[model samples]
Target chain A: MSKQFDNVSVVAKANVYFDGAVTSRTVLFADGSKKTLGIMMPGEYEFGTDSKEIMEIQSGELRVLLPGETEWKEIVGEGEFTVPANSKFKLEVRKVTDYICSYLP
Target chain B: MSKQFDNVSVVAKANVYFDGAVTSRTVLFADGSKKTLGIMMPGEYEFGTDSKEIMEIQSGELRVLLPGETEWKEIVGEGEFTVPANSKFKLEVRKVTDYICSYLP
Candidate 1:
């Protein structure tokens, strides 16, 4: 579904990682909360977080192995999963995937 | 550079396009303006728009043929370009490119 935002100011610079396997941009609003909007291509990735992160899958699919979990979980477009603070997680990408990371204090 | 938003809400659903070549998510704020965060992979693509669009290149590179321009221009990470309303443009992607489209009223 299409979404609407009241107002948003995008940061001028972008974040690039892993030889273009991942890229992200930061969006700033009038308030204080922050988020990173990014995309991931087909690859295996491990991510560590300082704070709790809400990983919202915007498109494609991800097979995730959360911290301490033996089974890999599938997350499709429009689906979301959360990682605990100071935790690490792994993702096995089968296809191109888009995502948004909302950090919680 | 990383970005910060005061308060923002992400629309649950994601926008997927072109067989995973592109995908995006909508973000909503308390006010009303809207934005689509997305990424594009390596390929040639043509895009048409109704409203004026500010395409920000977050990562990788893009060779663009703007409306009426016979020569292609390169826009790299942290670069941007504008497309007029009721216009079309072509992009020759040499690498994975991430972008954000801000639609202007």
Candidate 2:
């Protein structure tokens, strides 16, 4: 379900699942989008640059890799960080993880 | 986090917890609100009539009690239903449950 706002739109409800390895669809917004992303495990996954503009892991363990960066940055679990638009990132899921992400428009 | 829209507003992210028996704040919107509510257990909850205008359970188990009603209606897990504004509802959680509730404005 979706709700429209003056400057933002919310996908009110969604049930997303990822197996051992799965690539999510590249979510794009007019300018950006905001969402609550939850990883049900602690493991690793890669996020492409074409993904959302901004990503914030509200809760869970995640490792992020910026565009042109070779090493993964621990963003959650151990610490937290923000990812800029057009930047490539990856997440290392160590266990069942759940987080919230928002893409700015 | 919140984002503004032309006709609606979005509470982008929230982490709500129900400790077996707890009553949530009566969420009120200007005209309405949209939210995804999850019950992390299979039990029951009583939603007062002063709650949001509309509620939709996207997943998991839920039992609803309408205002002035003496019985509860199962809305999820086994079936699904919608709650109108100013209506009183209750949820019966039977197990570890998680469901999304959208409040429409």
Give the candidate number with the greatest DockQ. 1
- Identify the runs in model 1 with alpha carbons over 4 angstroms from their true place: A1-12, A27-32, A76-79, B1-14, B24-37, B56-59, B76-80, B98-105
Candidate 1 has a DockQ of 0.25
Error of 1 at A95 (Å): 3.7
Q: Assess each model's interface with DockQ, reporting 2 decimals per model.
A: 0.25, 0.14
Instruction: Give the per-residue lDDT of model 1 (tens digit) for B1-105.
Output: 365343556554456667657666665555666567776778898989999999877777779999999999998766889999999999998877767778888
Candidate models: Cα lDDT each: 0.75, 0.46
Cα lDDT tens digits for candidate 2, B1-105: 332223334333334344322211122244665444443444556665444544444445556676667877765444555666777666676543434455654
- Top candidate on lDDT is 1
TM-score for each predicted model, relative to the true structure: 0.70, 0.46
List the TM-score for candidate 1's chain B: 0.88
Q: For candidate 2, state the interface root-mean-square deviation in angstroms to 1 decimal.
A: 9.1
Candidate 2 per-residue lDDT, tens place, A29-67, comes to: 446544443434445566654444545454445566766
